[model samples]
Target: MIKKAVIGVLCAGIALGIGIVIGHFGISSGPSWLKDVAKDVDESFIERFMAEVNTIQIQENLRELTDVPHMATTAGDEKTVQTMLRRWLDDDDGLDDAWREEYNVYLSFPDANNPNKVTVVDAANVVKHSIREKEKPYTDDQRDPDVVQPYAAYSPAGHVKGKLVYANQGKPSDYEELSKKVNLTGTIAITRYGGAGRGAKAINAAPYGVAGVLVYTDPQDINDGFMSDTNETYPHSWYLPPSGVERGSFNRDFGDLLTPYLAAKEETYRIPPENIVGIPPIPIQPIGFEDAYVLICALDGDAAPFAWQGAFNCTYNLGGPGFKPTSAFSNSDVKMDIYNQEVIKNSANVMGIIRGSVEPDRYVIYGNHRDSWVHGAIDPSSGTSVMLEITRVLGRMVKQGIWRPRRSIIFGSWGAEEFGLIGSAEYTEVISCSSFSLTLHGCSYTLEKQMFRLNKTY
Candidate 1:
């Protein structure tokens, strides 16, 4: 908690402080009031060097990092990590040494073909409902079919047909109510995405022999009204647009499933298929509320309990046996064509050091993830820009021999975070296994008495 709080303050302070510096000096051009304020502190050299940490530079950095989809285990992601390394190595920054620590990570994700799909048909064999299986963006970089599709990572790839079952949030209690009305043996669990992590919905349903799981975010959950209809979404406001799918991993264990509790080293033993934990065996896919509406209205059964209601226009029904299976199989079918390939690939973790003076052994680490599902302008590119600006200012201070710290600081830019916390978890595992602790006088890159350390990974 202390570390988190300290880093939060540091990030906020660095951005705000630089903005103030630019406003009072660069933009205002040292107005009479600014000159008067500078007189009190005599205008330190660090203040004069504040040009490196301006808003323009920050935006430029953000633009560069968010230019492409840098999903974990992709070439785009590698490009982003290398870009940061180049910045650190440039002579202008005046840093000591920078290197990328690589780790072998296993990842599961959809491909360029948009492999996942869902369809709903009625007993008459008429396609009553179906999703376009796509996203519509209000701005550039927000929507790209080339990006990973709206499917849960680690979902087993297959196709299944069954009756639709509206299980509310798909929690245990919701399932208990579902059991009262129907048997889940050959059902497709359709639940609104809420009340828990999106992945949990599929996990909870899998044990009941559910054929498949479909999760979608209802607009009413946004701000009490739908986007565009009542308020702006994306590019205009932060609210998700109709086609926005909240993409995320469903790894219940919360880390790399294959190599838990240990660094994913080349020699580390890997988990077998059956032993792999925290991932569901059933196919799972996420969709926008627009697509969900079609299936929700097609459902025909008892209206769900009052507490199970959502913002949908029709009553939420625990849909059923679907016209008694017209011929052989039920006409109500839910199908998924998921393609999540897993491979052992290397991820780069960039660690840039700034040696400390008095308490060199003890460390303060500043860290953030670099990988994103798409052009992650908000999730990480924004945070990455802040980290870069902070590094620029701190490097300038170190070069000018000003504002040294008593304790060593490490700046960490973690990679492969989207596929679970792969980079940091691997680093932490290595540290734990080696029983490694920061050396009191490891090596000083800045100065002998006072040091300012910075490290980053993505």
Candidate 2:
């Protein structure tokens, strides 16, 4: 019985040894099997495509384009479009054919004979007062010299100067509170930048006979330091002039050159040249607190309600001095040459196509706006470069014959997006109207959906 048991044990030990050998070979060759899996997946093509996409060139392109003041209705915007076309579409190395298309869109600016230029009144008096009282001088140059002066696109021009009053946020509630606590009629109002659009604030102040308006960015509202409570880091010091900062007209309701809803309509609606709202009747501009401090200190009135105070590190005040008329002020007139004409011409939309063996008609379209405000680095170059790099990688895969998508892949770099989504919108509308088998808008959401579909099918 003992001998029979020993023989049985030896047989079990041999079986275990063979099992161990098989497991060792399988573990040692795992990576080789993975390679085969990759080959089955068209061999790391997707991975390479993604790696090429995450390049630095993309960011540089975007920054270069958006770094300037290219408002939609300016000659500078045309230059921006030309630059975008050259960078994305006019490539000598035949990777793809990308082009820009232009559409005649109506835009307007301030009319002549408008008293919309900002002027500093009683400057001599303010300066004299500052020096006599040993206070900080009211330096107009302290704010951004190149700051895009504030103006409603279609504002009727007029001029009046009244005692300046501080209205916080300029909201309806704030206006109600002002009505109770102080008289705003025949007063020029100054409001901080928050709560609503600058146009709304100006429009609300206009009904009260508030002659002129000055909007300013408060330090408390926009932080300067990293990890600060504010949404974005302050681009410049409070004392410096506001150059290249983003300033937009929020007077969409009153109708500006580019009306939001009208921009998307089928029948193009054009505002008459004479009636476009351009600048405030009274001159308006944004100033930093350093400049605002001089204006605020000159106030001769009751102490400002606590909630109406700013981050000037001083008590706020409502100009009063017993509500008695004390001083009159006037602004120097200036003229602005605003160009608003449509030059309709042929523009191109560049496209690259990769034919799919299985379903060539089904397409995955990818696009990014190539135009910039200035050197539009962050606004577009970043995304554009990314798209370009992605195209390059896919092109390489096709060249190597290593990868082929089941559905056709179409890549495009759009133009005139900064000028109210002109390029992309036109393309979508045209393709939709035509009998194209499949065309999709390359917006953010659509891109995500296309990616998901590609993953599932590929």
Q: Pick the candidate with the highest TM-score.
A: 1
Q: After superposition, how far is residue 369 of candidate 2 from its true place, in Å?
A: 4.7
Residue-level lDDT of model 2, residues 348-415, one tens digit each, is 34455566555556667776655443344445555555555566566666666766676667665555
Q: RMSDs, each prediction?
A: 15.1, 11.1
Estimate every model's Cα lDDT from 0 to 1. Answer: 0.71, 0.50
lDDT of 1 by residue, 1-458 (tens): 99999999999999999999888876646455455434444356546655556777778988999888888767778888888898766676634556788887777766655466677655565665567666875556656544666778777777777877888887877877798898889788888777866667777887787888888887777636555634566656777777778788877764556778878878888887668866777888888877777677666678889888777777777877442333322455765566666667888788776666656576666777888888877777777777777778777677677755556677767888777777777766774412224654443222111011234222
* Candidate 2 residue 281 C-alpha distance from true site, Å: 8.5
TM-score of each: 0.79, 0.60
**Residue 131 lDDT (model 1):** 75
Question: Which candidate has the top score in lDDT?
Answer: 1
Error of 2 at 236 (Å): 8.0
Q: How many collisions per candidate?
A: 15, 36
